[model samples]
Target: MHTSSTNNDQTTELDALLQILTTQVASLQASYRTSNTTERIPSLLKLKNLETLGPDSDPSLNETRRLIVSAATQLIHTVQSPIEIVQDYAGSTFKTVALGFVVDVNIPEVIRDLGGEKGMHVDDISVHVGIDTSYIARVLRYLATRHVFKELTPNVFAHNRISILLCKRRSFEEIKADPISRFDDAPFAAHVHMFSDEILIETLSAFSEFLKQKDLSSESVKDGNPEDTSASGPQSSAGLGPRTAFNLKFNTSKSFWEWIAQPGAKYEDLARTVAVVMRGGDKMVDEGQLVNAITTAASGTPIDSSTTDITNLLPLVVDVGGSSGSATFTIKNKVLQDVSGIKYVVQDLERPIDSARKFWAENDPRAIETRQVELLVHDFFTSQPPSCQNASIYILRMIIHDWADGEAKKILKRLREAAYPPLPLSTQAVSPEPKTGPRSKLIVFDTLARYTCDDPRENLNRSGKEGSTSVPWPLLGNLGVAGEGFSTMMDLGTMVALDGKERTRDDFEQLGKETGWKLESVKPGKLAAFIFSAF
Candidate 1:
């Protein structure tokens, strides 16, 4: 009787979820049609070519799509066998291996060259990639079953919407001519390669062993906070050098950055790939949104450049650890093109500073010639130079997630000291505030990690003030696979690679408080802008 009751309850829950899915699907269809000049939703097998009219282009459409995906995922879980789900999870590593294999061998490019939709036989593909015919067929077949590529026939494969994204957009001949620079133009492909190739794959393979063997050595324990002695999780040991799964696998004491910075063709290739991935991250948040975030954080109110003299109010914007000043240039060109006299400084290591000089020289020589922009070869771990101290704004784009809490604190502390330098011992008692001058703002642009369960703490925090799109009933608060997958994956990747983490809002607030900064506000998006003011 109890078994029957439980089954009936599950059936009722599935029916409710199905209804929600139907409603969401209808809403999505309507949104698509309205946004795309009354065009109908395309077939599943058809190639997607909607540029500005893509699902992500419209907010309502994206929200509806998330709902549908979440409902469908939950529905699948409801009916799918436990063993099947476990098997799928266990076999996912091969999926990554297969993806990395095809990308490395340039299968996507080969298929594109031959015939896009018409399809190519495995025998032909084998000739192009220099792999065994049967092996290529099996790999392609496996990927096809997962909808990565299309299987037009038993042993024939073709590029689909998903597979086409991995293309280098260069001719097969061009790729062959310069295989080293093939990924130079293909950020998405490079992204896949970086994640699936030996660097991450091999590092991740040591995760289980690394977890099982606890490092209770003095090196690990000394660097960590004495009060926070939690043995269940990984701890950061910046002073001791890299000690994560990456360190275990690579058998190196240097951090991932230091290791990658080593002089070698292989490291150079990996560095270039990293740069491409970072460049691709620009699409996460719009430049206009970033400008608004900066203005609000700097002035305590959003200033309209047309109405206010933004140049006079905010004299300098320091790009901390900014590689080649791409984000800075985006803000300058898009929003502050006409706002002259506002100095922009791009700070990084020697290599990136040199890259910045070259980039600016080719793009806008006047900015460099007139001294409006300065490229400084400075490390964030060190103190901010006298010239750049107490700037109106310091932008740290995608910087914080690269370090564990200990190192991240050091970086933030350096910025804090520069933003509000300590007063003399005699005057310190009279004035609690660090300085009489205008306070400098720190804007950290990074991923705002989300949780699957609905945490009320997030609702009460400043970072959570900007409410997310309402998830439908029965769907996870974060929309499960549809919404939080990338962020969670990134969290794990950072853990294995750098002993870093994608932090939640409370975590950010606590980190800020520890380093003598107060979290003032948050501008949420694909990459959130956590605005802080030195206290």
Candidate 2:
């Protein structure tokens, strides 16, 4: 009798929670002008967070949009989990096959070339794409159910917001058409191809094995390869290859860089894609913010006007380990005019230097002609090439956290040492130190994961639509997949691909303290964090 009463009480509590979720969902519909009780998916899909239906900032809509998404998520899972669990788990194979087919054959491009918003008939699309009509239709129809593409009529198809990404081009094109390369510099395509072909399959087989090999019984696997991170180990070329899953899978006795740098390595496309990915930092805090931080911090020390010589006022911006020099271009464009005689330098390996040179020559010839941007081949794990050391500003984007704290600190320490550049005496003479000036500032751009406990509805701006404010306990800062999304996925992939991990603000704090640098300020954005550093 007591057990029955307890069950009844628990069921009542769940029923109440469900009622709350349903009430909020209804409120969301009413606010969005779809309050009609009969409308089902049309209303559900209009919720904005669920689908990419394009931007609509209706003033009359309720401000707490995240609540609606959260409530709906909870309610849907509650109602669908029993049935969805089995299908979603086992059905991945079919979806993978269908997605792989479309990606491999460039179906998205065909559908796009045929008609984007208006869409194309299945027969016409198949004919244009040179695939069998019935087979393509069956696969697309299956994908439509998953919201990848849209089936307008029985045989017609249209590009949804998601499908448009897989097309050769983008509506908001951040990456440009690479005329030099045979493959399109399509970031999404590269991501899909790499994930589906290399990363996903490689990870599945090696993720478990790596743990077992590293002695899963001891949980200290969290410290990923301490020797590789230490000052001495990074200098040595031994025992670094097998530490990574990609190296292990390929059975290469070389580090990721050495392996990729070999002639005919066949990763040129992936290299281009990575350049696009590195430039993706623009989605977060404005590039100008970093520009402002560096320039302002380096200001106030004026050259003596009594001498009337501007030759001693040379300032340098070194983007350390800056693959492809993506950020370098942005920094140069933003501040080259404002800060006269400032030289922009991108220090990286031979591959990135070559890639950046090609990209910049075509993209921004002014930078090349003015001779403002110089690509220097220098390894970050070593001392900054003396030529670029003690620059006015040093920026590292996504460089740290590729190894354990031990290695991350070594990189930081080198940057710290380099920030105290020897003062150059005008034009031809070299001096030991800057006569009198501020130390160069080091700014790192990466994700600074943190739990921000704030009311979701407090900051009532349409910016709220970003869903980046503090989410409830279960969700991430971006309201991404309940605590496991791109960052988490990439974190794991880094472990396998490069033996790296993402760091929290605390981890950075420890790294900073150990590396002889002070944490100036942590500007956390919706996606990336701009961490400031000083000696």
Candidate 3:
């Protein structure tokens, strides 16, 4: 009787999940119909045009997607045996390794050139990549099973929608001609390679052992010698200590940035990958939403034709540590295109500032020629230069997540001091009050971490703000594995690589309060904008 009852309960839960899946599918179909597209699942042959759909681009579609993925994943968990599930996860590393191997060997480009959609046999692919036919078949089969590539026939593979994205657009010959610069035009491919390559994979491998050690604190980790503490064994870069899993794996005392700066083909390739990845940060938030966030924080309202003149109110925007000025360029082109008298500055280390000069020279030479945009070399750890002290807005995109809480606070404090500079002691008797001007705004564009379980505090904190999504019952609050997967993965990746983290709403609030700023509002999207005002 107890066994029968247990089976019945399991059936009931499965039924609930199926119902959720069915409902979400219907919603997705309705969205497709509204956009005048076929109400069928997107084709595997090509990328979907959901982004171009007018009204169908609403948050409802994303919500439905979240529900469908969550329900389906939960159903799989319900039916799959524990041992099977564990094995599937245990072998997951092979997926990354296989994907990386194919990408490194330029399999996607070769397949595209040799056999478009028709597919290529393992023998042909093996000849092109110089790998064993059987090995190529197995690796392709593994990826095909995961829906990364497609298996059209026995020992034959082709580029599916997912795999086709890895194409660098250059011909196979061209890529081979310039092997080192192959990823220069393919940022997405670079991003995948960075994660799956030896550096990140080896770093992640040390995570388990690294966590096992006592005193994983920053101080302890920084102080301990890698030679003495590394359980894996000693490394070539001896004398240096382990600050993170990356440090432990590589046996370097230098930070991720410092280590990457050293001269080497591998390090240079990794550096280029990181720079390319960072260039895509602006795409994380919608342009309109980002513009509104910055303008609203600058003035008391959003930008419009009849909006109050911001020339005298807020004259300049300083992008602190804004590598290559991509975000600054987005702002200049989108919001300040016609707003004359207002200036823009892109601040970074000397190397990035030099890159910024080249970037601006190509994109908008007039801005630099007219002195509308200035590239400045500055470090966030040091005091803000006198020129940037009175700037109206300071933008930090994907910057804060690169450091731990303590280091992150120092960066914030430096910006806070710049935004609200203390009154001069010599003029205390004459003008003692704080400088009278528009309250300087600090726009931190980064990921906002979400909890897997429902948290009432988030609901209260984001009461009237955007970026909050409702989770239906019977699913994890953050939509289980469907939603927040990338963010959580990034959280761990940052921790492994640089001892950094993604922050929750409470974390941002506390950081703001501690750094003499007030968290005014949050504009959430792929990368949430945390707008803070100097107190």
Candidate 4:
């Protein structure tokens, strides 16, 4: 009888502890929900001094606010515990693409088939994705820590609303079906890319050594032969592995491309890595542009689109490097949904052609059958397609930053030749020519070089105020990038992987003038990207 009484006392203590935890979680949930709701509706007072959008705001701000809030809420709901939340944010970088891959591959469907979604005892997402369950558990556990998905119980998984949205499907009709389409699809292959522990170690090691080198010139050395692990640099690094040790011993002698192009090298890694970045990079860009458009289109600060003339002046627009047709689709769906005779052209490398064609085939029959949107496999480095000569607006998203000034000029010069080929001396205009008409406007969307951009911290400040930063999203918080890892990675990754560098607003202004494309204006958006226009 005494033992029974002691057991009841223990049960009473357990219930009290449970009550405290329950109250805390409830409080957290309430705080998060309130913060998220407030973020969707920016105060009119907050619009002052913003570059991306002006005091003149999109008439559709109310609608956009509603959609953005709903999406953000669902995304936040995926994490249930503080530990899970921190892990979710901590593992966000690697797991973002992993979750993306599962979505791309339809892993959730397989899980649903095995009675997992219906509350089965086991829901092993890893096995469903064809990997060992333990590995998947580790990956998902990290992901769950970040809130990408959840651990309903050990080894069992369930989709948070965010993960549910991630499942490959059309969020809206006539837009790109999968979010992956908007971006370069290489990120979907991140699982394969990260498998190269050698490359990761080498890259990290190289960066570390380069960081320590007192003389920047000394940093250019690399292993003489891409195949030779022995080409030398620093001393006393014999304990390291071939790749890491090699980096410690040598500096990169040439640009990254030159190093990677050495004979007998496995180019697959570099190529896929580029493709993955190119793909994932696109979504960040497109989302940034959408935000910019919503903010600016109403004010006409950039284009004076206040009157009906805005519609008639430049009705049709084509995105030169538009991947998966996301930008084109988003613009049409958001701004020109009811407008007629609007044609959008999405061009990209040959690899995306099949994917693009398949995308158009499976959805948007009007776009496909009527040719409202055309997906073309055209290289940006090559001549501008003849069809683009008369396009009212030309949009290139994140394409310019991939190249330096010389190559950028070549691309722009080609665009000039395509749009306004120089007339022979015999046909020269009698009077000094004035820039007028549609102007074959080229809209280049890219991030300005952060090292020099005037408002480098504008986005971060806004994001922090938005509440995503104040509380910290798990993975982002750890990375010190709770707001937007996409931009952060873009800035850092370009420095490490490619010779391509981010530019400043002044850098862009100068580059535009040098290339013959007159700079209309450069508008820095809320997402930390700049929308540049030249005609």
Candidate 5:
């Protein structure tokens, strides 16, 4: 009994010692952790503070600690997500800039307003643009988030440096004084109707139907016999596959150019709207420095020679698919002014020519008398004429995205053929040593399919619709799928009216490659965003 008791005591003592050692080690570990955590608290807090404060806060270190604290407080704000607030502010500003397009509804007047470095304010802007105050303010608010305007308080806005390139500045009075021709104000904005409207919906719906049918088009076969290759062929027949069936059933009598050329059409609204948007900041050639920038960017060559005589060097310039000749008008005024033998050819359709002629005749008799530009009715999908062969340049301004791959290829092929015509029988052997160089370049000015530079402010203006103040979320989402300015209302009209659709940059390039044209480079600007050069 004594031995057992002694053993029990010893076991109890050993357990107590083990517990004490464990307690000491745990205490040491906790102390170390607490010390380490205390050391890092300030750093973690400092990192958490950066989310606060305005993006343009002073960088001076005099009040660095105070600034950090302030930033933390602002960063922790729960009223609105910082991103949301910024986006809203940007949207407000973008709306303001974009609404200008809708308000002015007059291209020349808009350009005239933007001729100088200092742009007009909302109130003064309203007077020039003929838009109401309340609506303009709302639009400006949305544009603000996008940084389209520096809201120097409510009802006032100062244009940004980059905003000055949206449009080519022009004298409204001069445009008014000149003949109101079709080319003078072709409905440029209205062209976006196809992508925004019924055509896209219909196309996608058809695609969905195709997918449902195991990747087969849902149209009925034309012939009763299974052996009839016409059922599977790429030919058009009534009640056939989607491509062929739609080709025949959905046949449009009037081409897009023809439809827009209709006398007294609503293109006037589009013209005036684009004019206002352009003039908002896109000052015309009046700013010689801006012109030089554009010239350098467009030409992709150094302008080193002081007396290169830019005008005389350009002989025959073809404005391919130059709707209403807005780009041509700007370029001619800016670059080709001194070139004596310069002749501008604006190609579209007989319909565009008729209105363009009327517009030219009514507006600028001297311009017409000088014969600076000749309107040519031509489809870009067909063969390019000899007159345009090896021309000094062919400028396709905002034209390439109007069709799908197949149609775009046809257009590109036409241009490519023009650049490199078939060797004649007589000159086949002596074909100028095979040229051994890239020539007859193609200039394209248009929007990218779904890409844009990060300017929360400018994006709103570029994508917003006329009359509405709210930023378009749906349109933004659909930019990659459809386009930025898409409208179902416009698509139905296009199908019944214009027979055209918008395309993406990828679509354009893919089509270009199929047509033996190589994409050389792309110059992205503020207004249209991208200019593609093809060889």
Candidate 6:
């Protein structure tokens, strides 16, 4: 009789859930109608961003995408059995294995070659990539269900938007000719390889072990606050294997980068792959580090170009560890037309600097020849004493999160040492607010690890104020599944790989205090401003 009552309760709950799902789907359709030009679902899939979109594409569809998918997923959860959920969860490891398989096989490329949208038979695709037809079909089928590939019919497939970018190589001319295409597809591949590959995923797989073995106070606690591992259920139970995870898995006194950099090391391929991926991934992720986020901090400062050479007072955008000047290039391209006399500087290791030289030479020789964009081959770890009188902004995008707090401090301290510059004579004045008196800032743009809330959907912080789309509920609370994919994956990935972490604003604020930069303003989306306090 009790079991019957419980079943009745579940039925009622499922009915309510179905109703909510219906409403959400309607809302999504309405939102799409308003936000997009096309009313057709197929047309929407062909949107320009879709050509290059991936886990971190800019001009993102964060808000709407979150709403539609989360609603569907939540609905599935409500209807699906507990046993089924557990089974899928356990079986999901095969998903990663399948991804690795196709990626390694370059299956997407083969599909494209066979005949892009028209697709080819499984046998042809298998023959082209030289894989067994049955095995390839099975793998392709699994990915198609997840929407990696479009299975038009039985044993036939084609490249959908998502599958297109999975191809290992891209035609530079094609990407350039089509301005709408994302130029960072190569780096995107690198990132995909980094995550989808065995070694990196191993770290994430041991997320459960990260807890049981990790000393809470080890200073190198992985990204996200130790106190808050919300939404992602019991993390100690999180890792499947008890013996190893994260730090224990890669037990070494040497840092992740150092270990990877060792001469002719066996992990060389992994390191090189990471290097390429890091370069490309920057283009996608750096857009979040808006120039306005920096400029807004200087909003009140009155700039009288007449008082000083306007050129001297022009804002400086510093891209520290900005590989191949990709981030700096975007900043320069965006700001060059509106703002005159602005200087863009990209500082990185020797190899990347050389690569940047080649890139600029080919893409915009005038910038390099004219010295408008300075590509300085300087390692970031050393003291970055100011060479010029004043640099308006030092942008450390996606850099600090690569290290533990101790090392992050070291990086910040170097910038703090270089942050303050003596005011240029013309602008120096007794006035409380000089519009253009060598105002300087250090901007750290990365994820501001928010605590996982029990009722994440309820506490959804629509960060429109910080400048990103807001997610309504049918969307996961923190967005999709309450900050599941990029947020948590990266947070944990870095833990095992580098002993680094994505930190909370409080964590950054504390670091500023320790490093001697006053936390001036914090815009949402993790853009933190620190003023140079060197007296």
User: What TM-score, over all chains together, does every model reach?
Assistant: 0.87, 0.71, 0.85, 0.49, 0.43, 0.73
Evaluated at residue 325, the lDDT of candidate 6 is: 77
Which parts of model 1 have CA positions greater than 4 angstroms off? Answer: 1-11, 37-39, 49-56, 213-240, 301-314, 337-340, 421-438, 460-465
Error of 4 at 151 (Å): 15
Best by lDDT: 1
Tell me how far candidate 3 lies from the true structure as C-alpha RMSD in angstroms. 6.7
Candidate with maximal TM-score: 1
Q: Per-residue lDDT tens digits of candidate 2, residues 1-535?
A: 0113234544653454455456656665555455333333333122232233422333234234554454455556666767776778667767666776787667777776656667788888776657899999999998888898888778787877576666645321212243223234455655665566543465556767776676655323544333344322232222354666676677765655455445653555455555454455434446655555555545532212332433333377788878677667776676555555677888777766788789888888787788778877777777777677656667877777466455566677677666653323341243222344455566777755433333332332212332333343332244433332456667776677666677766677667665555555555433343444443
Worst 10 residues of 6 by lDDT: 231-240
lDDT of 6: 0.59
> Which window of ten consecutive residues has the lowest lDDT sum in model 2?
171-180
Query: Lowest-scoring 10 consecutive residues by lDDT in candidate 3?
Result: 231-240
User: What's the lDDT for all of these models?
Assistant: 0.74, 0.58, 0.73, 0.47, 0.43, 0.59
Backbone clash pairs for candidate 2 read 229-407, 423-433
Q: In model 6, what is the error at residue 499, expressed in angstroms?
A: 1.2
Q: Ranking under lDDT, best-scoring first?
A: 1, 3, 6, 2, 4, 5
- Superposed model 4: Cα runs more than 4 Å off: 1-30, 33-197, 207-282, 285-291, 294-315, 419-438, 449-489, 518-529
TM-score of 2: 0.71
- TM-score of model 3 (CA atoms): 0.85
- Superior candidate under TM-score, 1 versus 2: 1
lDDT of 6 by residue, 1-535 (tens): 0112234544664454455457656655565555535432323124234443333232344444454555567778867899989998988878777877776666765676656677889888776667899999889899888887787888888877677667655543343354232223456555666667666666676677666666775434443332222312221111112123544566644445555667773467667777777755555444445655645644533232333543333356678887777767776676434656666788877777888889888887898788878888775656664663356677777777776665676676666556554433442232333243445567676776654432322222443234333443233435445345566767777766665677766677777766655566666543333333221
Q: Is candidate 2 or candidate 6 better by lDDT?
A: 6
Model with the higher lDDT, candidate 1 or 3: 1
Positional deviation of 40 in candidate 6, in angstroms?
1.1
